[model samples]
Every structure is written in structure tokens, then in C-alpha cells.
Target chain A: MNELFQKVLAENSILLFCYLIGSITFILGLKMLSHPASARKGNLVAAAGMLIAILATIFLYRTENMSHLGNYAWIFGGLLVGGVIGTLAAKKVQMTAMPEMVSLFNGTGGACAMLISMVEFNKIMEHHPEEMHRGHLLIIVLGAVIGTVSFAGSMIAWGKLAGKIKDKTIPGAQIINFLLFAGIIGLSIALVAGFATTLPVFYAILTLAAIYGILFVMPIGGADMPVVISLLNSFTGVAAAFGGFLYDNPVMLTGGILVGSAGTILTILMCNAMNRSLKNVLLGSFGGAKPGAAGAAKEGGGTYKEISMNDTATLMAYASKVLIIPGYGLAVAQAQHTCHELEKVLEEKGVEVAYGIHPVAGRMPGHMNVLLAEADVLYEKLLEMEDANDQMSSTNVVLILGANDVVNPAAKDDPSSPIYGMPILEVEKAEHVIVNKRSMKPGYAGIENELFFRPKTSMLFGDAKKVLQELVTELKQM
Target chain B: MFQEFAAFFITNYRLITIVILSIFLGIEVISRVPSVLHTPLMSGANAIHGVVIIGAIIVMGSAEPNDFVALILGFLAVVLGTLNVVGGFVVTDRMLEMFGKKKPKK
Candidate 1:
């Protein structure tokens, strides 16, 4: 008995030490993540913490029954298969597809949390069906509901962002979604109240929550995808936290809480950047089919003046200061490298060149920075929207490359516009504004840009990459 | 019933404290990040949640062989959790790799 007691005591102490180390490393890693230079090392540090936690659970914490080779095979097999597939996918996916991949991984976390809850519920039902505690049942229900919703919702977000799913809403879909959400809550309460069979009720809640998840995201437009993705990510984190609560594992609990809070903070920041509330994003159903041609056809209000490549080259080549504003169009064209080249050429000509990056310029937060950084653009050349706006007035010329909505004057001048009050690049403040695009079509927000029709703004119509290349060639001749 | 409630709180107060402390720390840390690293940070946090795989392994190990449903669920959880952890870290690392310093020779 004494030996058994000592063994138990030693194991508990070891588990405590591991949890402490894991928590500290996670904290340190996240602290390092605040800066770009140390972010990679931060990730590795957090990964090391995870490894320690996993090792402790496997060797020190497992029960005697789990010592069987069959259990080991399943556990290691999962790690090997998942590790290989995840590594390959991460390696193969392009930077442009990063947001979708993040959503996919977030869904996997949600799935694991949901499965844990389900397995735990089954275990309890089989062993202690007669003495179920309400608190335990509540945690299980919350984990299942939130996790299933996050998993399903993230998949839809991934599909929508990846162009696999169309952003179409069935009539009265919002009402139906509300009803499904209410139904899930009601069923969860009933399960806790012991009014029905535990297993079926649990599954019913899962199914309803899954449906609610799909319906919740189906109506949201592409413009709101980043917010939705962040929100769903937080949901998954919260669900995982509930799983942690169910198991009383300190490391799991800390990790889940950390992710949950961080995701929530990001969601809030993205919402503020768009000047929209979370409720509006969820219910406003902002984005849909590209704004029809009728909006642009009503162009009698103003006409856009087109500038040829030679003229554009002359203007940029002689300019004292030039600001380049890049948007999703640049990303779609994969022209960041060429854009960087243009910056270099202009810099060599004694012109001060800098980038104006709107906070929400690309599909995801900081997306423009990633694209430009990939092309080895100097970090100092990239300016935040506020700083760029501060210098826009004295700027001799502003080159808007495949960027529209962020530069749209409607954000400030037109109160009737949907994107009104949203922060923009204010590129029109420059003396000369040149916009590079394929045509006069509206941007992703499906709104015609008032800046396009301004006298100071000249449309340089073409693919951003080809236009930049042609302009570079023209500048060389000049 | 009151004594049972107190006992529950006594057993779980430490966990509740950890959860609250971690949440505050998370928010504080995340708020300091520049917008440029938001995507990578989000992906990194996603991977951290894969720590749930430990829960899965523990549950599966303790599960009886006859408990087929629990076994299957636990196994799938392990797979999904591993994927989240591995994919999240690798993808975040790839993204951070692109944010290199300016080349000296060039």
C-alpha cells in the first residue's frame, strides 16, 4: 500500500511539473509573437510546450489498461497520419490560400473538441447513467454544441473563401437559423433536466447545431468573411476550453482559454476596422453577387479619364514622391514582386516611394503585408493607412494598383454608401491619382468608386502585373 | 447539497483561476501584435488548441475494448487534433519565413 501511494504521489508531482512548464512556455511564446523577428521562435517554443504535455499524458498519466499495444498503435498511428498530411498540406498551400487553410485547421480543432465531448458523454452514460451531475452534463452539452457549430461553420467559411461554395441565401434563412439555434438550446436544457434519453438528445443537439452553423455562414458575403472566420475560430477555442473543463486538465484549460481570448480580440479588432458591429456582420448579409452593370452604367454623374502607359511612366518617373496602394487585386494577379520591382526602379530615379496599406486591404488582416514581405519589400517602405494618409496631400502622385474599395472616397464623402464611415486609404488626397485595373468595374464591395471619376484620378486600365511591367519598361526608355 | 457545491468549488477553484488568468494573458499578448502578423498569430493559436489531443489519448487509453463508439471517437479526435496542431504550426512557420530581412548582397 505504501509503495502504491508513493508511485501515485510521484506521478501526480511529475504531471504538475509538466503542466507548469507547458503553461509558462505558452505564455512566453505568445509574448514573443507580438514582434515579427521573434514570432517564429515563439511558435517553436509553444510547440515544445505542447510536446512536453503530450509526452507526460502518454507515459505518466495513462491508466494500466491503456498500457496495451493496441492503444499505442492507435495513438501513434493518428499522430503519424495526421502529422504527414498536415505537413504536406501546409507545405503545398500557397500564401494566397493561407486564410482558407487556417479555417480548415480551426475546423479540425473544433472536430476534436466535439468528439471528446461525445466520447466522454458515452462513457458516462455507460458507467454512471443513474447519477449524472448537472454540471458535468452542462459542460458536455456546451462542448458538443459549440464544437459542432464551429466545425461546420468553419468548413462553410473555407468553402466560401475558396470559391467552392456560392454566397447565396435561401429566403427566410435567417429566421430558420434563429429557430435552429433556439431548438439546440432547448434540447440541451432538456438533456440536463433528465427529460429524455441522453444519447439521442445529445446527437440531436449536435445535428441541430451543425445545421445552425451552416445556415449562419451561408448568408454572410465575402466582404464579411474575415470577421466570420475569426468569430468561428473563437467559437472553436471556447468549445475546446469546455473540453478542458470536462477533463480538469490544467494545460488543456490554459491553452483553450488562451486561444479563445485571442480569437475574440482579433474578431473585435477586425469588426472595428470595418466600422461594423458583430451583430451587423452576422445579420446584415452584406456581400452578394457583384454589383450589376447598371450601377456603373449610370456614369453620367462623372466620367473617368484614362491615361496611357507612356504618359503614366512620365508622370511617375518625374514625380518627387509617389505612394503605391496595393489591394486584393494585386494579390489575385500575383503581382507583388513586379510591384516591388516598380518601387525599386522609381527609387533609383531619386523618387521617394512608399506603400499605403489599409488595415483591411486584403481578404485577411495583414494580408497585404504578407504578400509584399514575400517579395522582399523593405519593412520601412510599408506605411499604415493613417501614416500614409498623413502624407497623401504633399504626395506628387499616388499609384492605386488593383485597389478600389479601400481607396473609395465613398467611405468619407457619401453617407448613402454601404461602406460609408469605413476607414479608407484616402489616396485621392494626392495631386495625381492613377488607378490600375482591368476595367471600370466596381471593387469587391460592389460599389462604384467616386475616386475613379475624380478629375485628379486617371484610370490606367490593365492587369496590375502587366501594367507594372509595361510601366517599368516605359520608365527605362524615359 | 450546499456541502457538495462547496466541495466542487474547492476541487475546481484552481482550474477556474488558471482559466481566468490565461484569458487575460491571451488578450494582453494578442493586443500587442502588429496587424502584419495577425494571420500567423491566429494560426498559431489554433495549433495550441490541438493540445486537446492529450485529452483524447487519455480517454482512449482508459476506454474499454468493448467500448467501440468511444474508441472510434477518441481515435478520430486524436487524428483531428494532431492535424490542427501540425498544420497550424507548419503553416504559421511558412508565413513567418516570408517576412525575411532585406538581403545584403542584392
Candidate 2:
């Protein structure tokens, strides 16, 4: 073989080796991520792979290509800005705000793809304007049109997540949404018809793309964010891959392909969780007008008992064993840190502390766990409902923080309630149940939480974090 | 070494993108399960974002263009790309919060 040919093969081998190693790391990361016990290890493994890949790439780069140095400068600068922003958001966002964060990530990923497509357009226009072949042009136009829609659609998702777009059903929203999608698809087909070089066609496609994005995600609500987030993330991946094709870059193509495929699959999975399709979830205004029924139900079965933080803390302090039950309300109030402090105080008194976690405790899956981890709680202390329920008989006190649904006895007894079969924290089996909540309002599923009205349960109504803090202060006194 | 990969990556352009995006989406799907594993998925995905920092190498390697617009845009992509990479790590670390201990009910 020619020496230059051999050298090229060797280089390819090295890069391929690096890529495989990185891919293995990802697989290992996923495997380890299957449970909390191994998550840290998985993260470390994945990080190691990333580190290796980065190092390998640096080693492979030829010194001859010095002109692309500006890309490095941009990369580092982006790291600085994005890093700060991400850090601040993580630190500041309440546990309850995680769904919103997911939504924002969905938006950001789409925007990044959109921007990548724009850059690709510039590259094609400047370097190979006349050389643009039909296939490449098709990819370019598809990228621009899709990328734009994803970007604006993700923003609308953000709005829905933020409650800026109210849950109220708007007349003709569905028809309008369908028309927008159809029109965008039609324009996209036209865009691929080798007419992209025309200015009016290009601009019109751009307008339609932007509008389509907004309309695409506008009807989605907070309840369906996880699915939307996954779908949009997949869209970003596809867009990125197309951008990679335009640039003839192997890395982008591979990376984009991975993201797009993975995202699509995940979107499907999320949809199944809600027993809906991507189309229905995005267009049907899911969870519409149903929660209002819960609002009304909350008004009935309204037996009342209230307690102050100090009183609640005194009970917690005196108890020899305590179990904390967290739900969406806990996440919403960002009370994890304060709850951690309460855990510490209770533990100091020789109280055995445990947390009962339900499968569907928050808006998104694992919502409660994320919040508790933020408060610096031990991973071992959290027991699943099945595991913890067996122990509830011996539990002296069950502190319900920011929880609404998971403790409701109606799940086991009332056939009429929506959450009848769903397993919950068996707090009723405990000696005492102390629930800290914002109000008597029903949870996302809109069922009245009978736990709130239980005779043994004392309702400490206020903000969850604030009440947790107060309880901590009182625990200190006790 | 990561810097080198970063440079190689930006230079190679799109070689890694398709694979990365596919993996990302796959993780997204897998992580949606309300099981004990979602956090780990996020952490792993985040670890892959280390690829973003390589954008620095790309920025440094690309030529200074005669026309400033593409140059500026390219520069911006690299910068943002790098930010996304490092930020991904930080976010991954935070995601580890999913492993918090649940207090025993008894």
C-alpha cells in the first residue's frame, strides 16, 4: 500500500477507535443509570469517555488547518456564557421548576439546530453557491424549514410550560394548528422542489416555518411537557444531522443521527405513558378542563384541621420514627433544602428517618427525587412505596410535605376517584399523619386528596419551603 | 487531548453529529420512564456533551475569512458549542441529585 494511504488508514483507525470508546462509555453510562445506586458511576464513566474523545480529537488534528482557530475561540466563549447561565439556572430553579427547565432545554436545543442550519446556508451560499447539487440543496432546504419550525415551536412550548399560554381551550385552536402544520408541510415540499434559490420562495418558507413552530407547540400544556421536550429534542438532532450533511462533516452527521433517532423513540415512549399519540398530545390540549373538576371536588369532603409549623415540628421532634412523603407540591415549593434540615434535626433526636416515594409523585417522572437530591438527602434513605409501606405500621409520624395525591386513602377505597388503583404512600397506616401543603386544591390528576381530610392528618397550610423552614426552627427549639 | 478531539471534531465537521444526536434521542426516550434510572440517563447524555468543548479546536483551526460575516458566525458557533459542552457537565452533575435517599417509612 502507498505510505500516504497507510497513514490515512491509520488516522482513520485512531479516530474510529476513539469514537468506539466514546460510544462504549455512553452505553455503560446508560446501563449504570438504570438505578440511583449506579448513577454516579455511570456519570463518571460517560465523563471519562467524553474526556477521552476530546483528547483523542485534539491529538488527531493536523497543524496545517490553522485557519479554523476562530471556531475554537467561539467554542470557548460559548462555554463560558452557557456554563454560567446553566449553573445559575440549576442552582436557582426550584425543584418544582424542573419541568420548566426541561421545556427550556427543549427550546434551546431547537434554537441551536436552527442556528446551525443558518450557518450551513451561509457556507453553501458563499463557498459552493453554483456548485450546490440537487441532493445537497434538498438537504439544506429541509434543514432550514424544519429547523425554523422546531425553534419557534420549542419557544411556544416554553410559553406553555411558563403558564404564559393559559390552559383554557381556544376556539378553532385545533383546526388552525392543523392548517398550520399542513401548510408548513406543503411549503417544505415546495422548498425541496429545486426552487429554494428563488428569494420569495425562500422567505415565504421561512415565515411559514416560524409560524408553524409557534403553532406546533402552542397548544401543548404543562402536563405533556415531557413528551414535547423529547420530541423537540429529536427534531434538534435531525436538524443537526442535516446541517452535518451540508458541511460534509462526519461528526455532526453521526451525532445528529444519534440524537434524532433516540429522541424520536423517547417521544413515543413518553406518549405511551399518557396513553396518547404525538399528534394528539401536541394538538388535543390534553388535561384540558379536567383539572377544573378536581377544583370542584376539592370543595367537598372538606373536613378541616390546620396546624402551625411550630406545632408540626414539635410532633416531628417527639416522634421516635418519621417518614417523609414528597409529591409535586414539595417540588413546587422548592422545599427540599429545608426538608433536609428537618431530616437532620429529626435524625439527631434518634428518630429513624425514611422517605416514601410513589412512582408518579410529580408532573414529570422522578420529579420528587430530583428535588430531594437538591436538598442533599441521602440516596439510601428513600424507600419506594412498596418497600416503605411495610414499615409504615411502625412509623410514629408520617410528615407529608408538599404532597397531595400519593397519600390519599381514596385510592384504595373510592371507586369513583380517578387515582383509584394507583399505589400510594401508606401513610394512613402510620400512627400520625402531618401534611404540609399550599392549599386544599387537588393534584394534577384532579382528585381530592382524602389524606388532607383524614382525622389523624393535620394540615399545615402555607408554602412548603417556608413551612419546612419554620418546622426546622421549631425542631431546633424542641 | 480533549482539546485535540475538539479541534479534530470541528474540523471533521459533522462526523460525530448524527451518532451523538441519535444517542441523545435514545437516552431521552429511555430516561422518561419514572423508574430509578432516569437521572443516570441524563448524566450519561450530559457526559457526551463533552464533545461541545471541542468546538474550541474547530474555532482555532478554521481560517480567518476575508468576509467577516461567515467568520463571525463560525466564531459564534464555536463559542456557543464550547459553552454547551462544559455547561453540559455542570448540568450532569446537578442531575445526579436524582439519587437522594428516601427516608424509611417505619
lDDT tens digits by residue: candidate 2, A105-132: 5455445555555555566666677765
TM-score, every prediction? 0.93, 0.78
Q: What CAPRI grade goes to candidate 1?
A: medium
Overall local distance difference test of candidate 1: 0.84
Give per-model CA RMSD. 2.8, 6.7
Off by over 4 Å in 2: A1-13, A48-106, A125-131, A153-169, A195-200, A244-254, A261-286, A295-302, A307-320, A408-421, A454-456, A475-478, B1-34, B43-64, B97-106
Candidate 1 lDDT over A1-478, as tens digits, reads 7987787778878987998788788778777776887888998899999889888887778454324224777788888888899999999997878889999999998999889889888877888888777677888899889999999999999999898998886788878988998899899988987787478889999999999989899888875787888888888878878877887878888888888898899888888787778887888445543455326534654777999999999999999999999988888788999999999899899999999999888778888888898888988889998899999999999999888888888889888777899999887778999999988777767777878888898999989999999999888777
At residue A133, candidate 2 shows an lDDT of 54
Candidate 1 structure quality by residue, lDDT tens digits, B1-49: 4555566678788888888888898899888788777778888887887
Docking class of 2: acceptable
